[model samples]
Target: MRQDTEVRTFRDGPSPATRRRVLAGGALAAGLGGVGAAASEARTAEVGGVRHGTVRADGVDVFYREAGRPDAPVFLLLHGFANSSFYFRHLMPRLADRFRLIAPDLPSFGFTVVPDDRGYVYDFASLSRTVGAFVDALGLRRYLLYTFDYGAPVGWDLALAHPERIAGIVSQNGNAYLEGLGEAAWAPLRAYWAKPNAAAVESIRARMTLDGVKAPYFHGVPDPSVIEPESYTLDAAILARPGNADRQVTLKLDYKRNLERYPLIQAYFRERRPKLLAVWGRNDLFFIPPGAEAFRRDIPDARVRFLDTGHFALETNGDDIAREIRDFF
Candidate 1:
């Protein structure tokens, strides 16, 4: 059993090297429109000492970013809505020296290519299965999980399915409690959920635009100027793909399924008692701070820390988050 440790707060700005790599990656992605040639360049660039590649998993070309020594303890990073492994560009390099970090872009979100003939369903279960296959393809028997936004449910599904494989979990705004659902932030989604009609679809569809993609990054952030345009720009470009918007809509609806399984996830936390570190952005418009606090309900020892940022916490607080992970683990 891991020994208990006091939580230490870190407030340093991202290192110059980390900033340069992030800007370089954003520039490359923005220049290449965030996919196809851009992804190709990322595969070979080794930006920020991180390597990008793809592996065949569940019949999809899963694009992922990897760093750190191969023999070190693995940290599988699962991203959330409208973002990809690109979101981890800063956090990866910071911890690469100490732990093996792998961040994969899920289907419909990042550079992962899903063939038209595969007839993929953009739901949580299907998404989880693909990630599971990706894990199998990599032969990862045990590893820690770093889940954010949509990643929370996906990681929870993996843990529930194979409790033995998960060494611990680092949930960064990855919600698993009912109270975590911020009513106002999720109003649009809730309206759609209540009535899956054309109007409801249109309401959620508004979020697919470039401005919509940028909203979360600025919300709850202390200094909006610090947030980079490349991050949301890349997300917007990929989301503008021919069929990706509709797939995103399908995913929004399927999120209800994740909420339904909250009890089961909490039960896992109670029974398995996996080491949990909930580092949250208190001002997040979507998943609120209570969600982080709720983790302690099931696992009393679960560490819950809140940052002064919003939904995309890493955009403004990458250094602090990386430090917390290092100290906690």
Candidate 2:
């Protein structure tokens, strides 16, 4: 049950379990802070063009937007850390015309609620676990996995573990191995995952922004208005929660540790070797083109499109992205 990008730790408040720790002096990141931006775009979710709302999942209620025939090919869309299913709302229906588009609010984001007081472990492991459960709960044993940003790792793990269950994959700006920019969390999290400080913590928080969200979408596109500010706002709000900054810092720290499990991720690709459609924001300031090349290294049949967008490929390239999914299938 993550919105955890790279990190995977801290459940039941704090768990004594197996993990890796990279650097030191990064834990002091208790302080972090957002944009007025535009309101969230109006997204209409319909089932066969019939308006639909939320869907239920075990131990958590998932608010999702779906459309098209249930019998059609299934396309499951997932967003990044601090992002909700809303990013797909604008794109899912159009794709639903050809396939059953399912986009859900992952555990801690969007309309999905988590009691901060109870301390749900929001990390990559939980994300990977719950996504597999979500498929079983919905009786979707076979479907295309659409992943972006943090969704990459979660979906990758799923595809690796259950290759037969995955029909295909839509890789949109999701991290594969250590492909993204070695930013604040990348180094510090890896270096000081177990032991951290506010200074190192502050560096991680500095990267969050509406512009950062929009930058990726602008990569190949000729227009900038395509960016929806509210989506960035949603991401920013999650960081605003009390102790969230620390949680993010801790999680990122954990993600670096999780990085040590790289051999597993790489081996999964070799073992499963599923067809991957790589849709990327070439100009993505975060996970740039070098990262895009990494996908090709593992999956030989990878078909890549460097969109003029950033991490949220569903926004600017929604129509084309959906079409690409159809082509891959």
Candidate 3:
């Protein structure tokens, strides 16, 4: 039993390089217009005519990609670490045609633009509040959630805090419980949380690889030239910023903080009982399959599906995931 049990992770786990992988990307389209406005127009045209928008929160500007008419049912999408709002690019169009889709770049990541002189902290609770504020700012009465990776905690907490406003939940490769990790797999994050300093930061950054980034999903090709070089370059730039490393390490520290709050989050999901869906990249090396299993154990009546992809399953199997979310509505 001990030997067999040695193989799991999730219900667990952060770092300096960890910080870089997490907050590595933002935008300043408070109105999703002007320079962003023209881009939104092009996006709408690309996706069969949806809306483009940006929101201002805390001290940063958040750029968002939305589709469908404002009056339609709402679908709120959240992304994971080391990723910006770009994770949902392909999926947005597919669902935007049927529902009011809203995808934000969060605060420190993406083109929404972070403040030059301020220190930004990206914790689950902080991000949760950011999302909540964005939802409230848009005046969305209630909306479905599409959460992935780090997004699951942020969005889940938001839904728990505001159950009245949640329609249903669609999660892919997200964690909602404790005790889900392998020791080797979780070491770096644990170290980062313990010591979020410069050395830790550089050490973690050095291990990241193009192949490593795509290892989370179960896709057909291992080398997708589209994502590797450019994404890593963008993330490298963010890591170079002053204090940005610490902001990222703070996000890693939240793993323990979030784990402590896991029971409450599960209770919220149980008592409120929103429609929950789980999609996974069977190939994810970090947050393994058991994480999905734990979510099902608590989220009673969750619809779970697995894909042969990596961590960012949305990038590879977006259309199918988007359809699953739309069908739920």
Candidate 4:
């Protein structure tokens, strides 16, 4: 999961077509702003307790974990690449008393199911579209976005599409800066983007095994035993599903699209300057700590802290993260 955290700027400037699309999207976003704000005002009561359920949205059965008061300020948790909403199991209960937590399994991951019609693109853009629909289906008008790993792109995409809906952002090793892409770890991905052949596919899928599932969770923890076994066990089971490995490979190949959008994502931060809090695992090989510090460039007041953990910081610092989130939100 390691990446080269060197700043890279692709595409000198937006093409004429890109400019037109951005203008059109801006108009649409302005029109939709009031819709979410009004909805938030209506659902102001706190929810009762933690629960699990599924909602049919965007042609997928989206599974999610919910806790805290229905009327409490909402916190939308977006998990990383190898894990689902389950990754937030420990952190969710910790803050349930103060916040309304909604953590969903993105399409092609976790318990969420998508039909086999090949209609779903499984790329970041398509996943982002599905998440937007998922949020609408759940009637979540506004919330703080907690994004990690893969969730970073998805959450940012949603924010850009519906800026009015984002109350703030909490980035935990969720990289948006190009300098955060460390080359050594990103070799396989870079190879895939360049060649995209069977060998490249194999390189991307190499980590789909059990060892790979366990690697990130324990990467930098002083006492690996502190990380629950169930975390990797559940993720490995999901990865072993029929066609799941291939689906993941497809997503990995599509990661380049996210890199392409990095500039635009940064632009959103510079322009909108949403309230940002970044809690990073300093020892993380993937999305290294520098990525967290980079947030301040776009958001002067962004609060960034480094935890002594790995990619899955929650595995080692769940209590601290929960506390930080509670105080901040």
Question: Per-candidate RMSD vs. true structure?
Answer: 11.5, 13.7, 12.7, 11.4
Residue-by-residue lDDT tens digits, candidate 4, 1-329? 11112112212223344323221222222221232232242233233344666666677667777765454567889998899999988888788766667898998789987878637777888888778877776666678899999999999999989888788899999999888876777988888677767886776688899998888888888889898999999999999999888889888888888889989889999999998999988888878777889999999999998888888999889998987886776
TM-score of each: 0.85, 0.75, 0.75, 0.85
Q: Which 10-residue window in model 3 sums to the lowest lDDT? A: 1-10
lDDT for each residue of candidate 2 in 114-210, tens digit (9 for 90 to 100): 5545356777776667666565555565677888877777787777777776777877877676765636325655445666677766666665545
Worst 10 residues of 1 by lDDT: 1-10
- Using TM-score, give the best candidate's number: 1
- Predicted structure 2, TM vs. truth: 0.75
lDDT (Cα, tens digit) per residue for candidate 1, span 141-192: 6788999999999999999998987888999999999899999878877887
lDDT of each: 0.81, 0.61, 0.61, 0.77
lDDT of 3: 0.61
The alpha-carbon lDDT assigned to residue 285 of candidate 1 equals 86
**Model 1 off-target regions past 4 Å?**
1-48
The number of clashing residue pairs in model 1 is: 0
Query: In model 1, which residue pairs have backbone atoms overlapping below 3 Å?
Result: none
Better of 1 and 4 by TM-score: 1
Off by over 4 Å in 2: 1-58, 115-119, 179-195, 207-222, 241-244
